[model samples]
Target: MVIVPILLLLLLPFVGAQWLVCGDSGNYTSNSTYQANLMLLSSTLPNKAVSNTSVFATATVGHAPDIIYALTLCHGDITDASDCESCVAAAFKDAQLSCPYNKEVSTYYDYFMLRFSNHNFLLANSTEDQMKWINLRNTLNFTTGGDSITHLLFMLLNSTAQAAANSSRRFTTSRLGVNIVPTVYCFMQCTPDLTPHDCAACLQVVLKHTLKFLDGAQGGRILGTRCSMRYELYHFYEGVPMLAIPVVNGTTPAPTPATRHNSRKRVLWIIAGVAPLLSILLCVICSVVWTRRRRQGKVNLNDQAATNRPEENELVWRLEEKSSEFTLFDFSEILHATHNFSKENLLGQGGFGPVYKGQLPDGMQIAVKRLASHSGQGFTEFKNEVELIAKLQHNNLVKLLGCCIQGEEKLLVYEYLPNKSLDFFIFERNRTAFIDWNKRRVIIEGIAQGLLYLHKHSWLRIIHRDLKASNILLDQDMNPKISDFGLAKIFSSNDTQGSTKRVVGTYGYMSPEYASEGIYSIKSDVFSFGVLLLEILSGKRNSGFYQYGDFLNLLGYSWQLWEGGTWIELLDASIAKEICTSDARRYINIALMCVQESADDRPTMSDVVAMLNSESGILPEPNHPGYFNLRVSKTHEFFVPCSNNDVTITEEPHGR
Candidate 1:
């Protein structure tokens, strides 16, 4: 009992912090003019010494149509110059990425704001002085997300609002112990000019929004227009005491030992009573379902009209749902299906995202993605994928099941394929032996068909911004299915291309036009396919690629060897071990044709399909591929050895 009590006490703070971290987004874009103002204020403030605080920020430009401004602020407790500067710089980098092109972007980090606008910066601080005026306090609108919690949260915010109104420092903080802890933590601030009542009301509005926008977060806030309110379950502010003014009735809530004790007792009794009953009920139900499973007859539901009715994503279920009528799998069903997402079910990892194998309660299998909380980018990617894949349906595409997003927890459910990704056989040291020439040809053709569906044949034309071997999901018979449409783009029927300042795709596989200038089109995808084809032939990645001899990347190396009639040297030794010489040469020539420098020079998907399916067509000698030979050094032995399109690096030679 003594040890347990001591352990509980020590874990209290850590538990609170962990809860805060899990429910919180590592970075969020600031959306209000008040955020812009706060950004300017923080930027002007000098870094301070270590005290009890920190600071944060981000900048935005161009999208929201606002004036340029900058912001910089430290945690109220910060009193050290060096730490403040360092924290501010760190905060700025994070914000810059989160709000890359928008005119009004801001995000919160551990501490500090590095916000700025291409259009405006607020210069309004009290007393005709700039520096000291900016140091008052840093407050943001905290949204806890919902009615009951929101009301209480706003009430606490009013306390800080009232303090800021009465103080000369334009800073005020209030402690609020609510939800899960016993201590209070809340803050409010302004540009040092607003009245107490104005600050109170302004903060209240900001707090309400914060709760709605970031529900269940232990600590989060909104940067707003006139004033801001911030609250965390944990302590966040630090500084010398400022003149204080209370905002609420003098009465504090009465002690609740009786209520808490009753609640605990009730919870224990309920658990004790419910666990056995629920287990018994579940076992009976399972027994019934299993009995039903054995006697159930297969329903003939294969007609396109009968089973593949075109709901928003109805066709996805057609392929993945077996016979339509998508069944909702219980949490336990998925758990049992995947053997609890076991290591043996593990498929692959990228940017730390792991794919697990699962078997449904009905004996159907699935692939589950248990995303990393630290991979904050995965959240947006998840949302983007859900929106797109749910609407896309085609024979060559992978299927997306319903996703699970509770608080910071995120999961992607997918149709499980028995054969796994194409990269497994192409890239692994010994796996290629299983892939004979005939299977390799089928896999290559399947990928082309999938790309055609995305770029032209499907209901919505999509640009699979990222295309590589690993993303090619394989079925039981080794037929290829395109996966990971997270970065894919949709265009109107007539649209053929789009542009993005922030281009993201696998490096070596990107087209010259897309990589060099951020331009993309169906033709751009063709460029990628050509690179993929070359990699497939050689089982080597073009990006960060290196040969033992003088070669920059796979593309350049292939070109060098082909130009010298030694292209056979570039083939995957495994493929070279058995491929038909004529077919292999034809594929190599076609791949080169697809990678021409000019996007217009590349063949259309129609032509690519025709070429791949052809046997007697006279093929032209191909031109040099676009972005042909960018290369790098590979000193890291543990570096990822990518099979077809898995990016690999080569050592940098001393001379050009």
Candidate 2:
């Protein structure tokens, strides 16, 4: 059975009182600089919000270490500027009293919402702070045509959300009427600053949560930091709805006596027609089931001897128990899908093995990663990826469908992405123009959100030791998904870093400490992300970039331009005209910060995401990047090249 995570308060009636959330970003003393900044924001933010046509305002006060970010948003239905200002000012005072000395506070009132924090949550891409309140007083369900009512409710909500996202004000109200139930008055809104895609995504998330608790309730609402929605039986807002859908085909009227008699005869004829067909269908299903089970039994008996090994037995058992959707494919089935692993079907080859594009009998396309017997990665790495990726569920991470383990053959299956990887478009001159500045920005944000999930949000703390352009796959919509987890490492909640004698990863992406001393941490992954970010921005491969004067790699060349205050020259020619100069500079600053020589100087993935989304705050200056001083030469340098292939390097290296 599935369990819905419903809070206990969901069962109680919503009193429309002020709701508050005290954040865990630590507290400040009354007379501290942080408190003073908070006070200044509280005093000015009300006027700022009232002056705006959208009645929404965001402000950042003070400098680093004591900066305060605050935002106030008045409900879309509230038309009076005085009321909006008054609600916001009262929220600031009430929030301080509710959570004394707190550095982060979120206050929700009936007409307005106020939030202040040391962290910039105004544009953060997360729904962790969503709130929901249900109207338990209305315990009525649409007993008449219940299925149709539920379907109508969802349809209304979905359309309303889309309307809100597309509107200039980012707010919309709608009502739908049906013969079998009362009209549902819907309210949907997002902060005007949000992009249409982000607003829709945020609304969808809250809608799922709200529906789980709603269960066809008469009234309910989900309030989130970025977006919100509400539906009630009675009209709750002041003005008329933007959309009003009339009832259509909701329910059929009762039949007359003569029609009832005819209906009975029709039903009898329909039963007679379907009975024979149903019996034959049942027989066919039983025959198919019997044959399949017999074949599976024979295969199981044949494989029993090979599965006797303890390690293999444990691995198979754990995988089967981990997820019911995890399938154990037969070698014959895979062969049929890939047409005997034909050369034409091959997609790419990696350190682990070759990948092929295949279609199953049911017409589902998949990417099959067939592990080569002599590949550097073996059973341990395969097992790690299968177990780890199966548990991670995120939009930006590739989905693992299943695996196959037969004698001398092992394969992993994933959802097929037609656009291939980031490297395919960014590095190719002809394809560089395909991804404009907006698309590139989306890819960057998607990758950052994926890394943030792996590092802090997922059930298991993970570090993708091999993050690069090739490992980032693009879907049909041009969204990025992080793939290739064979080199990932898991850490406990308390563990911050790890070291090993066996250092492994691509050369240009590895952090200095991880490459020279075999010490790896979350920062190691950040370093790789930094290198990938630069490559995306410049449309040049970092491993072989040697055109600049005395510069060995892209990092050194980028530093030269950055130091000279000519960083705009580092951007790809295609996007240089499309992107704002300020945004390009901000992105370069963030990438440089990620590749800092000292791990302590680099920001965490959380901080990186904030910086990427934040448009107002002053970013910290970056130190010199790692490998920034290296020069190209024929002779061996401090670190010698051990392999011709730049895909991966598994050998141990000496300190520089």
Candidate 3:
């Protein structure tokens, strides 16, 4: 979520008005079959919901002429079993008082919701369901006239919705802290029965409905049969928020000349008023000036960017203070080193720009990433890469030496890896012999450790949104180091997941939830790593087709071979004879486990490492991988079978 600094409206409306109910109030006669079914549903729901481990239950109380369908859902964050039971119990009681004898009704509480209908609503989309809403009286008015604040708020809400859509519990809350407005706390949820994509679509409709009543309000909530969303000034749910938007405090407004003159006038008036008590006035003025200067001296200049709203140059200055090792390279020096941006010096290309191999005057080799000026999101990318990579240090991760910010040219310098990237060796025929079984195993473990550092051991929780073979650089010793901070996302220590609509990543490598719904977490990265792991083990790329099998993509082909017990055929002919059968099979199994369609089913990096180290542990069976159905490209003019490699780079929204 992008935070735009704006004035916050603090006034709140009546608290009791923060609830809504929407449904038909159909009349039903007392002692009728409909009434009996309704009564049975109400009586059975509370105890059934309480007893279920998930604290959620659905039931049908009759058949044919009269039947009632009901479900109770506890908020994903609600942990106390008793609290969930009480909330559902109260919802039942409230429904009776609120809409007696109504056949279809929905009721919402802070931590739980109880809904029932005469129709089967488990798979129903939100559009068919009318929304109930409550909005705050306080308007979120920004002094400036622009859509930045509104865009930021919606981005946060959409991200929260996406998270909920992909989550196992179908619920999530988020915080969007922008410079322009007070922190907006958002929560979104959907019925767990819906698929990830369907849930996302449902929440999208709910979001659109919310804007109708919530526009400019400090906060609001919308409830529906399939979904619910809320944005408030304060946290309204239990547990930690899943997505915490990175705060970007906008530039502070500079005082105008007229304001300075007014301040002088006020000072003159004060002096005139205190002239009769000159001694006391002089003492008061002295004390005020001394205290103000002392406070200013103690201010943290290291993070001046947050308060002062500095430009790129000021950002460089402040960053220099934070880390002396990350030098600010001179433009002339970079020009001299790279031979004035010669084409021969270019190494590879990325989404933002080109990377060139440069040799400095001191004989130090470096890789310089020259960001493209026309790539509208370049500034943010530059800031993110510089700030994030400079703080992270590990043998399996690329090292940021420094950066150059000269006018239109923004360059990031890193220690150049002589072996190019993993793609150069993995996808080429002649280079196949270079990475033997031992080397591939080492490279796989190294990459896993790098991910572990980012997810668990780093100073900040990091998610490498784009993790693929091309982004993994290789050193002289055949060791792998993960690169590309441009697409990386930083999560608050407490946050576990995030989402976005502008999905930026290499296509075939993306997990199902992330590729289809834009929801990402550490598990998303784990999914990408799984693809990479399989690529390393089998000497096959996941994105392209193979000529030997009917399977369209590498994942499907690998699964086909694995299940058929012809797994040995999946291995590269070069390394097959020398590799251990059990070890190779075990690694393949681990890769499959990592690429499970559901994020919750995937193991963490720590678990991956432990599983790899264990000699003989029973591994769980992996479900079908995401995108397994996409065997071949549909838009081919001529079917060449295996010549084309489809690696797409998208301008996706920033992850939470």
Whole-model Cα lDDT of every candidate shown, in order: 0.57, 0.77, 0.71
TM-scores, all models, native as reference: 0.47, 0.51, 0.51
TM-score of 3: 0.51
Ranking, lDDT, top scorer first: 2, 3, 1
Measured on C-alpha atoms, candidate 1 has an lDDT of 0.57
Off by over 4 Å in 2: 1-315, 318-324, 633-656
lDDT, candidate 3, residue 489? 80
Provide the lowest-lDDT 10-residue window in model 2.
1-10
Cα lDDT tens digits, model 1, 269-316, are 445334433453464465455435422312211121132212212212
Candidate 3, 505-547: lDDT as tens digits: 7756888777666678999999999999888877777764443
